[model samples]
Target: MTTFQKVNRYKKIIQDYINKHPEKNSDDVLKHLLLRHIPLNKDSEQSLQALSKFRTTINPFFRELVKTLKNPEKNIIEVLDIYLKANPIKKNDDFFALLVAYFNSFEDLYTNKDLQNNTALYQQVIVPLHLYRERMEKDKVDLACELLERRPVLKYEDRDLNAINFMSPDYRRISSEYYENQRIKDSVRKDHRLACEMIRTMAIPKKELGRVITDLLKKIDSDDSLVYLIFETLGSLPIPKDQQSIVVTKLLEKVQNSKNRSDSEAAVKALIKIPIPKQQGEQVAGILLENIYSGTYDFRSLVPKLASIEGQLERVVTHAIETASKSKPSSRIFDNSPEYTTHRLACESLKILAGLPILTESLRERAVDVFLILAGYSDQQMYRPALEAFREMTIPESRHEKVVNKLLENVDSKDGIYCSYSCQALAVPTVFEGYHEKIINKLMEKIRDPNGKNIIYFCVALASMPLLEHQHDEVSNRLFELVDTKNSDDFGYTVQQAFRALLKMADSNEEYEKVAAKILEKLDSGDYRVKCSVCNVLRGAVLPERFHVRVVTKLLELIDGKDYTVMNNVCETLGKFPIPTSLVEQVVSKLLPCVDITSGHHSIDKCACEALGNISIPEHQHEVVFNKLYDRIDTFKGSFPQSVKPDACEAIGKINFNALQCPVIFYKLFMRVMNPDNVFETLNRDNMILNTLSALYNKMTPTERINIVARLESMQDDVASKQPNRLPFLLSVIQKCQSINAFSAGLLSHLPAEKAEDVRSGMVR
Candidate 1:
């Protein structure tokens, strides 16, 4: 069959099950249904369709499938993944059984005796052998060998070792055990599988693993593998609690004798994980730092993890960074990850340790040279890293204010934006105060410098401008000029953002008028998104007497527009207020048409429901919205995406508190909101529904608030601790209780002393 017809035939089979079973998640059933089709080409739409179809489903089965299959020579994994993804429970009964069924019928081949040879079926068939080997029994393996007609040997050293992907910690040990039992030498034989297996074995038992690795480290030639193994083992294994000094001793020996670059790095890393007593560990760390200090060991990959170590790691990290400054960054330790991210994380870590004294004058000079060398690297986050580390190492803002002032003096064009970012980072409000003028001047020049050719520089430069502002006019003038830019390419988003920054600095009408005018002008702009953007900005603006008339005129006009999104933003923004009786009906009419129609876009739908929340005053419109949400509740069986359903609850959250006649419906809607649905598969996406959920809970009574919190707490055992949001819900309860207690306390304080005492005593009684 053609790939298309064959896939359609399989999809039909899955869909028929969905129609028949209905109980299985739509995604899982579909995966099992689609397993017959395979060799999905990258260019083929089959992958896209399958992903798109199943992305709607909410199970970890697909991720497991991806993990199950990633082999160099295999297509059956994809088929098996889909089958199990569609039928996890069915397949979970026995992965071996599932695999046996999958390979047992190679339909068209039809060689009865070829199938009879269990060895050929298990080994040559290519699908079930590896996965089954990981989990299967000795008896099952014999049966598999009988059917396939070849021994299914999964141990790397015993088979085509080069073909195997790197195994896990368990599988790695398995390979190592197999090799040792056969009396094979890893060095002369060159078995990658055995090497990987040994590496993984080290992760679980560091002292024992460290001892074995010391032997292997003597012979290992590949620095990369040795280093990673050493790093992983150190990173994962616990140091022997009773004999910590032994681990330190082994690591010191490993780093001293280690010829491979990564092996040396691993030895360094493993040393950090060892629990040397503070005074003793400090001495041991000093020794490791001396080796790195002496320029004996090389570190390429373990630098970050090394930098991340506590106690003596600082000495090691500082020494290595210092060493890198002298030696050319031998493509060994040069990392290309985001500079600011690495810098920020490292600084935070250093900051937590009293301070970073390692960044002294000699260190600073070397760091500067390293930054200059690294400037040519392609990754943008690099410069920020250096600046942050420099920021830490440089004397504290209190001690080195003069140094920053001196640096600010060199703010000329010679040093460039990299220097400028570094200087500004050093001079931040907490860091430097007197150099604000020089810093701002440099920022404006960089921001306006068309040839400066740096977007991130300008973006960060502008974002940082308001951080420590003494003068407002120059800042406002600079911001205003950008806002009124006639250039079409100047998408108002950035400048509008700068205006928000300005709002944070502004206090009076004069400041508000200039800011509000810029925002209003954008709202009236021809671009649809700009208009929506304008509404969002204006909604957040302070409603002063001067700006209110202008903002209201455009807002009312926006409410009358056909772009549903703009209208939604307008009505939603307006709903936050006490609606004038006259405009209440107009807003209601604007929202009525959106009542139960699933908005093609979520934002427009959000705006519509938010606006409706103010006044569902019209009777029929109220019934339409309530019933529409009521009917749609069951539309998503188990795997419904919560975004669509969250809105339904949000719309109810608003209407429930407003003038809706159905208190019973509101109560039921609140209960449904409290229930955990499969639609909310992941909590990573911020659903506006939580905003609605919180708002609905707030509008509720003490009993209702308790009801919501109680329901939220029940999901804790089932949901991943990181995934479910318990903090916000718990805070809301505490906040409500505090407010109520404070008000009661204030009222009781007003009574006569005797009566107050009696009241207090009565409470105790």
Candidate 2:
């Protein structure tokens, strides 16, 4: 008979038996057919066609085979052995796909204790895998990765080693025995690549794998891509610290010699991933800094990476400051000298370093001196960088007075730009401890001088400080004179600064009344900037309770004007009022539409949320406000602007669940906290969720708390394994409960042993 006819005849016989024994399951049918010694007719096109048709009729049988292989109690080795021996699936057979599926499911099998202990069974599985590996065309590399990942510690028996040798295309040395053959010298590159892929995919114990990886690193030549891949794999292994330092040093050398930008970037990246010893920290920092100055590559991207090293921060900070301090003005006016260019680069670097979260006392002192000199320089371009560096520095308490005095001295100088920069710097509240009065007097003296063309600078300086109650009257009157007498349009920046300062001094009812009247007068100004300034000043004024009605009336009128900036400012001002219950509906009705608009204007939405949160504080209004915020959160899940969601979360957190008289509120928030799909991953959102849970925890009854805690305990394993931070965050929420309960005990017991003990000790205290 022909091959197709022969296979069809077999199918007919199996179909007849299945029909006769209809009560038998698919497994029984598969075993019966396998026991009959059905021929696969290996590699025949006709047999392949027939088998494809036959597999469709026996689909259930293949599924049953998969289930058996996955069952932990079954001897997987024996099952695979029987199936491979009986069926003898060829590369072209229809059963090959099913077998591949079976291989893919072996991840869980690797975790089985029986498979780990049975060395003989390991031999049985590897025999067929080696055959399959050799036959695989498209998925050969993938199958290799899977095999390594599944059995990373698979013993290298002679048969297994022979299989690896046979699979390599470059293995050309002929010998009577596989182990006796010498590998071709030209195959070293291919061998190294294969070794890296093996090491990367396998979970070989670090002690055994580390040496292999290090030796591979040594054998590779100047092939950047190969070196990069090997370095990445090395990063994953727990190599000894001393060995890691050696790898870091070699990578640094590679970075120095690499002319290819991509290669250099990759080398630097790998170097940073391995922690450098404290003694070697400066060398790494110096090399990276030198690379940055050479301009061969975009080393600016490496600033954050460099800053992450433990001991590199001080050195980087010192180098940048020293470079910037050496800057001097060009001898020829307006000519950009080489020194000027170098100084500019240094100052830019200093700004980046200052922005880093790590700032030592010595570095801060150095930064202060460099910035002060830069600010005092004649070049206007240097002022902004200097001011930025100054703002970022954590000035020591002992140096605060000296720094403030130096800035004040610059403010008294004839250089208008320098004076303004100094004034702005002194505006930081902590800079003027006892010197507030002295600085404010100096600014007022400058503002009072009719010759003071820099009155705008002095106005901004005064506005930046926190005005005390006793000095309010004088500061306010002088600021008012500047805003009214001076044409605000001519110096709009100055007018805004002066008006903002005047409103800040309005602490009492009389002062607020006076400031409100002045702002109301300016609200009619033709200049849009003046109107914007008036709206901004109104935001800061503490209107009296009686004046709230009038203030709200004026703000509502402005809200009708439809200028987004003015309306946004108005919404923020309206939220600050402790409105009477009679006005809640009017206030909420006006604000809700603004919040509901999804036009991507986050500021307006943010202000509306804040206003709604403020008005929703009344006991009777909690449920209505809660539903509104909840619906907004639901409507815009992932597409919402960053600020809107956190604002909504915070607003929802402010609701009084007890006052709402709805027990479901607690459950709803609890579910929202636990739903991983719904949670935003940002730190702000996570913190807001934690805050919301803390709020709900305080209100939850013991039964409700237990339910929540039980859910947390159930999810603890998945969460702890995926995101370790979440466990501590959830524990923090539980800690906020009014009192501990049995739920707490159950939750604690689910934590890892050390963490659970720490939590137990904390609870006792």
Candidate 3:
């Protein structure tokens, strides 16, 4: 028949099948027809034309099939057998592609007993695979490797099969006379390569394979390439722990002696796979230290591997500190001195060692001495590393007192950087816990010292302390006394710092109430700066219950005060507290007039929006709050300035739409933000819209969610075309909603693979 006639004939057959099975989609029917017909005329014009028509007529079924077959239950040999039987191509290229597809579908079958017992089926697969490899095509060799490396269910009785023989070359070379004769003819490196590949590919009995691998290791000598291959092979094997220790010992020796960095790194990599016994840790640490000092490899790469070896942490730390101490500071100005290089390496290594979770007291003390020496260096570069190292070290409880004393000595040092670092180190909660009362007394004394220049440092240290509820009254009383008596001209900022600490330390309602009363007293201060600072403190210390009401009343009273700074701070703090349901209307009424963005003071308007957003009420008030926020957004959309729009958007996003069951609000917000003209320019505004949609998603019904996904998909093309950068954000929104429903998840499976992956990873983050 003519080519056109044949193409027409095949198309009719496909169409008839699709018509008969309406439940089966057009794409599925097209896949079945192509699989049946392509192999018969793979290289013919008729088949090529038919393939082109089919491609245009259906979705990409082959890609979907590949993904489906990756699932373990669907990747069975029976499924592959059906496909192979239907698509019987003759051309080698087409046939190899089919074979690869089949091999890739072979899921891990190591524990499939029924398949293991089916000897007949094993023979059927083995004979054809062996013949295909014997053809010796370059691609076929790779295909053979891919198939043989899989965990096969074949038994030892199948050793006679050529496919099995191909995978067992190392075993045959060591244990069989014929293979040994063949190996003698090959180059030494080639033989080693073959043996390593064999070990990697074959599932030989453990006892026999272990003996062969040991013998091979013994034969490996000065050849770095062979040693690298051998170590890599050993890493993949499931050797027993005792055997692993022996392997680690041998690899560590190689790591120390090998001049080649790659070889040493490979040996280290192998050692990491094997567990070193606690007793061997010191020896292992010694060898690693020697390699590190050799300076042949990047020492940073070695630190993590050394850290992974449990036990002997003390030995490693001590060795690292000693090596770092030997690195003298450079004397020359612009020369690349060995001393500088060594010092830098030492500092880096010390930082890593000190950061390790396990540390002995002696090792920590030695590390502290090294850090102090580095910290004392005049150059900021030298001291910054020391500060970082000290910060990471968890000073033991026993050493906290000693460390605190050492830090206190530095607190009065001439160098401001050193004093700052010392104060920061002492600020850590655990370090401060041991000396809380003494530190508080010392800070109070320093704050009271008329000539004391370190009051700021003292106030900061006090703020950093983890004041317990039991100590709250004592600490608050002392700090409050400073605030009450300190002159606003001399120590106003210091007093603010004291109030900051007091606010953080206060825990109970009564404690917060006392703080509130003091704050109210400060609000009446003549100095606007004092009132403003008090307002900032109040933002963080908004009390619960009746105290909240009282605090709100005080903040509201100050909002209309004459000073703009005081009014701004008061409005900002008022917005932060969650106004109760009874007070929502009153609070909203007061804040609404402040929402006028055209008024020169945008801060007041911003704070008003923020406060209104934070107003807490029953579900019944959702529409009220949403409409007020939305009206502000609509009013500002085109005509108003851009700065105020985000405040309005954020305020709208923060409203409790879920409680109000206001899906339509979310839908409208999404459509507005996703408008093609608006999406790219307002990418920063997408977060608020996404959060709104996410809240709506949880409250949506199944059918409603499906409709949402459909709408998103419909607009996806426009989004990609106009705002390609927002595609990931768009997909993330859909994925978050669809992930809860399997039906929606399947519907979204057609999204680009990378985009889908980005969606998943974004959700995980």
Candidate 4:
């Protein structure tokens, strides 16, 4: 008979026996047919394929069929080759069972000699053999060793090694075999797989590893891949103290001499991980500083490493300041010169100094003085960095007066940029509190000048200062007068700054009421930027109880505006209010429609979805709000903008779902994740849903979590049958639920002894 006809005939016979012996399961019936009519030699590529149509029946028969074979090892290889060729996804239980039977029948499959050089068979059986080694009675460690000796490189070494480790207690043997394979291959050509595996192994001796690195560095110029892999291996593994100088010298040579910028950067990254010898620290810092001067590397990456070297922080800082002082400004209007590079390096250096872990008291004072001097430089770029570094430092309380006097002097400078940054600097802690009167009076003088440059920054500095009750009205009114009401576009930024200042000074409901009145007056000024800014302030500010009603009403009024920006900001503001019971319906009713796909604007829809997350939805309004978000997930049809679904998931988790509603909410979020079309299975989207699931699971009663887990388990079969690709997502949800319950019930510490090490490693990873 033809292969197709013969397969069909076998299928007919199996089905007939199954029908006759309905009392017996399919596995039992398949076993009966295999021993009685279908001989062991009857197996074929087409026959296996036809029998595979009967799930779970082939596994039992494979177990029994292997026992009857004369040359089981050879026959099993044939079966595996045909089966693997047919089903490459390789998740079938029957295929796994066949592998188990194959290993059980052989004392050493590699001992067959015919199979040792069978690369195809070796490649296919390597992963499965390691995986099922625990089930076999024979010690397969030797077989695994032989397999690795022949096939030492794998693309997926992390998974492959993890499987190999399961077979043998001495992983050092497996690791060393792979390392030696790479060493031998390195003479002919570089094998990155072997190199990467060596980096992961903890068994390679320090002297041997150093020799490998030294050899690789000799050929670093000829092969670019060796440069990256060798450095990565060095960075990941700790260098022996005796070999540190040898490696550091070579890397420094690369950093100083190599023309390739990426090579230099990689060398610097590896150097950062190595513990610099105390004697070489200064030399390392000096080389890095030279690169920093040329602007060849990011100073942020280099400076911290420079500071980390013993006693080199001050040298780096001083060099930066001295270099900056010598750079003269270009007389040309648009100049790109070494002068600009020097000034930028200086500014970054100042910021980096403040960020260093240990700045001695003397060095701190010097840093403060140098920053003040650079603040007065004609270069406008130095202003913010100067103040930014000044802000980050904790000026000794004793020096607060001296620092404030210097800053106040700059506040009066004719350089508007310098004066504004000085004002910003004055808002720092002890200085702001100790000298508020002087600082505010100086700023008040600047704000009164209507045409003053950088007035918005001055206003921002003023807003950041806390106000006394007596000074609130005068300072706020002065800022408000600076707003150009008739044509806000001319002063839109300044207007936003003024409104923000008023919002900051509002410490009470009465204070916020005044700010609200100013906001109400500008809401119709035809400038959406102003409207958006005011809404943003309310969105971020903690609205007092007295202002909630008035603000919620105004926000609700703006919710229907045609401008999406205004509507987006308005929805975001309304979300922050603790909507009174009387206004919950109005707020929910307005927001529900905006979260729909028909809204035509993603920003508005996204904001509306997020707004639903924060609203105090009365029990009566939960169903409607949920239904709107439910329609927004696009579980089967990715019709909504991808941005809207995660927000919807967040909003669903935030809802106060009743007993009947929790499961419904979880099912939607879980299944939405399972359906790939929802956000295309983006990691970000999956994480958002996973976080929402975890949070929601935590909120449930222990009993509710149990019921939810049970319900989730019941859907696994449907997921396997219909959407098998998403089995991981389903499994993740179940594991996450169980993990949350374990932690909440204080059972994490009580896990069985065998799993303790695995759990700790998982947590560390």
Best by TM-score: 4
Give the residue spans of candidate 1 off by over 4 A: 1-378, 384-395, 398-427, 441-475, 501-507, 532-536, 539-553, 563-602, 606-642, 647-765
lDDT of 2 by residue, 314-392 (tens): 7676767877888775556565555676677777777777766677777777777787777767676666678765566
Model 4 clash count equals 0
Give the per-residue Cα lDDT of candidate 2 at 275.
68
State the RMSD for candidate 3: 18.5
**C-alpha positional error of residue 60 in candidate 2 after TM-score superposition, expressed in Å:** 54
| lDDT of each residue in 1-765, candidate 3, tens digit only | 533234334434543453354244323543555466454633433443434344433334443454444454563445434444555433243333333323212211111333334443334443444443233223323432332232323223333334444566565643464454434433445544554654554444444545655654665564455677778777777766666667777887788777777778778777666667777877887777765755555677677567666676665666778877765555455535555666667788888877777666777778877877776665554566677776678655655666666666666666656766766776776655658776666656655666656555566666777555544455566577678755545456656767777666666777767777787788788887788777777666645567666666766787766676777777787777656556667776677776763556547777777776676644666676666666666665464455566667777766655522544676687766656555324434345656556766655544344445545644555664676545546665765665555443443366565655444332311
- Considering only N, C-alpha and C atoms within 3 Å, which residue pairs clash in candidate 2? none
C-alpha lDDT of candidate 3 relative to the true structure: 0.59
Give Cα distance to truth, residue 738, candidate 3, Å. 1.1
Better of 1 and 2 by TM-score: 2
Q: Which model is ahead, 2 or 4, in terms of lDDT?
A: 4
Q: What order do candidates take by TM-score, descending?
A: 4, 2, 3, 1
Each candidate's TM vs. the true structure? 0.40, 0.50, 0.48, 0.57
Write model 4 residue lDDT over 329-427, tens digit each, in one string.
445666656668766777777677765658767766767766666666666666567677777776656566777787777766776567766766777
Evaluate all candidate structures by whole-model CA lDDT and list the values in order.
0.47, 0.59, 0.59, 0.63
Give per-residue CA lDDT, model 1, range 1-765, as digits (tens): 432233234434543554445344323432464343322322233444443344433344544554444332544434444454354432222333433433321211222232334333334333343333233223322322232222133334454334446665556766666666455333323333333332332212232444443433443433344445545444445544554665566666656776666666666666655555454555555555444323333333333334444554547546545443333222334554443324423322333222344345554454445544443333334444444544554444343544554344434334345555555554445445566665666666665565443333344444555544534555566566555554545445645555666675577777777677777778778877677656666566555655655665567777667777676677667655345555556666655555444455645554555555655455546666666655555365554334445555666666644322332453454345445553332321344444555455445433233323333333333432342233233333334433443453455557666665554333321
